[model samples]
Target: MKKWLQFLVLITSITSTSALLASGGIGEGSEGRSSQMPPVMNAKWKAECSGCHMLYHPGLLPERSWKAVMAGLDKHFGESAGLDAATRDEITSFLVLNSADKSANRRSSRINQSIPTNSTPLRVSETRYFISKHDEISASTFKRKSVGSSANCIACHRGAEKGDFSESQVRIPR
Candidate 1:
């Protein structure tokens, strides 16, 4: 009985260790692994959205926020981003289907958790989760020419389009 208990403990230890390593260490989030990438890209969403700015992953916002943004494309962020009915419907459907609330990714889950039940934020940078993750960064850093602004996530997150925002991969520019 004593020997069996010892063997069980050894197996448990090995299993735990292997899981930690495979997951790229504990508490590293879904993007902890360097090779991990975001969900498959929607070609239409990428083309239309990136024409004006960085292509934000739909998993960054909630369904309601995406709906609101889609509904206001004619006045999107002070610019006209209007699209034809069919195109707009396709993009809106894709975004809502993949929104944070529907995602299983840890970062998306965190973003969903940070949102207030009564609030619908169109910008990922305005979420409490975004603010907390960026709390260590100063306003001046975001205003630097290299960074442009907090909205420019690609400045530090090289894999922003791919949805990889691992802390270990961040490289803030001077």
Candidate 2:
């Protein structure tokens, strides 16, 4: 009985260690390792998107959606926001490189999954996720100093550009 118990304990420990390694064990595995993590925002994206809209994070939309949005910027949110062909290509590439398709969340991978493909509104706000997250804010809240626009995610979500949206970082302006 004692020998059997010892064997079982050893096997459990080895199995657990192997599982951790297989599942991208933080410092112990190579899966999560990177040469250097990319910054959340850069000069290019900031310069382009920040002109009329807030510098929204590119990771918010899936690659397909970003491409779709970029392709039809003339009709973007019912406005003539088209970029020049060269600028459009640059922005589109950047967006696709950091899109939700590469995110760990399976739901985020399917960003437009629940919406009809033919939907006219290609804006991020039209997504179900955005609606649920922003529902608590009143209509007049946008007038507040904290929120400049719906695209101004950094106002409510500190370090959002770096992919950090922890509640502790939230600082609502008075």
Query: Against the unseen true structure, what C-alpha lDDT does each candidate score?
Result: 0.86, 0.66
Instruction: Quote the positional error of residue 70 for candidate 2 in Å.
Output: 0.7
TM-score of each: 0.80, 0.61
Q: Which candidate wins on TM-score?
A: 1
Off by over 4 Å in 2: 1-38, 105-121, 143-146
Clashing pairs in 2: none
lDDT by residue (99-129, candidate 2, tens digit) is 7656544334435454455653356667776
List CA RMSD, all candidates.
Answer: 5.6, 7.3
Count of steric clashes across candidates, in order:
0, 0
Per-residue lDDT over 1-174 for candidate 1, one digit per residue giving the tens place of the 0 to 100 score: 999999999999999998876655554454653233356578899999999788788888999999999999999999999999999999999999888888877778889999998999989999999999899999999999999999898999987887877666689999
